[model samples]
Target: MSVVKPLPNYLVQRYRGWKATTYDNNKAWYRHLSNEGQHPRAMIISCCDSRVHVTAIFGADSGEFFIHRNIANLVPPYEPDGGRHGTSAAVEYAVTALKVAHIVVVGHSSCGGVKGCHDMCSGHAPALEEPTSFVGRWMDVLRPGYERVKDIEDEAERVRALEYEAVKTSIDNLMTFPFVKESVESDLLTLHGLWNNIAEGALEQLDPKTGSFVPV
Candidate 1:
């Protein structure tokens, strides 16, 4: 016999009139949403950090954006292959199925993935089993970040550079998709890069001119 685990009662739980009360407040639109499928206008690639939830940060409804999460928000360098590309697949579906017009890559500071890249760049990785440790693989994916930031002198500056480069690299990878590239060429889709700092609660956007993330 399988033991049943207790489930969260978020559906009914109330805290300062936040939960069920919220549902009650949005009942009319929620009811309509239940009857129809999602139609999001933007696609966001966010880090897999729980504290950096995309929808919550943006106050988005269930169907407002197509979101994909990954370590460091890394988008693998494009491979022109018939092989399955998980990130590519999501991008294709977002632009094709959801008809999203904007794609955003969101990065954050104090990132474990960015930390991994920092450790690797500083020659300080912890012991790993070689053939396959997720951290090792993720660090490998962040080589481009290191390449962009390694020459910097200050430690803090290096981390900041990695944070921004990682976001740009993901955007670059998004352009690899034929659909994304074509849409961009046709001026039907736009790309954006965003950075969030957890400690300071600061948000910085990539300055397309200098490729650095600046406040607001």
Candidate 2:
């Protein structure tokens, strides 16, 4: 027997409300989208943190962006070893298939994954170091980023620096893919790194020229 359960009452109510209002009001537009298919302009790689609302951040409507969310928003270096790579697969489809013009790696403040990476790298979280921990293996992608910010004396500042490094590191890893590199060199695609201050509602974008993050 299956153990699946239905949605909670609140979510059911919310869905009904949206179906009755928003969906009803935009029936034609929704039908048009269904018929025409999605043609998003950019691909956004963002952290899985619930607080980071990718669409709301840019006030983007449906089908405006191809978004992928993962822990710490870290992208591993291109490894054609034939392993199960969800993030890489998404990138491949977005770039080679969808042909998105831009790819953005977004990191944010108060990221639990980033914090776990920091803790594990600092030898403060032993459980994450275990071989059985999936999160530990996933966070290994950010080890380089942690190395860059490990020496910072202040704990808060160090974590924040690591967050920014996470974005930069992911962008670097993204360029490792042959298609990504080709698209970038040919000027067919652009790469961007962004860091969001969750509490302050502020965003900082990486300035490639200076290799620094500045207000967007």
Point to the candidate with the largest lDDT.
2
TM-score of each: 0.86, 0.98
- Give the worst 10-residue stretch by lDDT in candidate 1: 11-20
Model 1: per-residue Cα lDDT over 59-98, one tens digit each: 8986788889988887787676887777778888898888
How much lDDT does each candidate structure score? 0.81, 0.95
lDDT per residue for candidate 2 within 61-153, as digits (tens), equals 878999999999989999999899999999999999999999999999999999999999999999999999999999999999999989999
Off by over 4 Å in 1: 1-4, 8-19, 80-84, 126-129
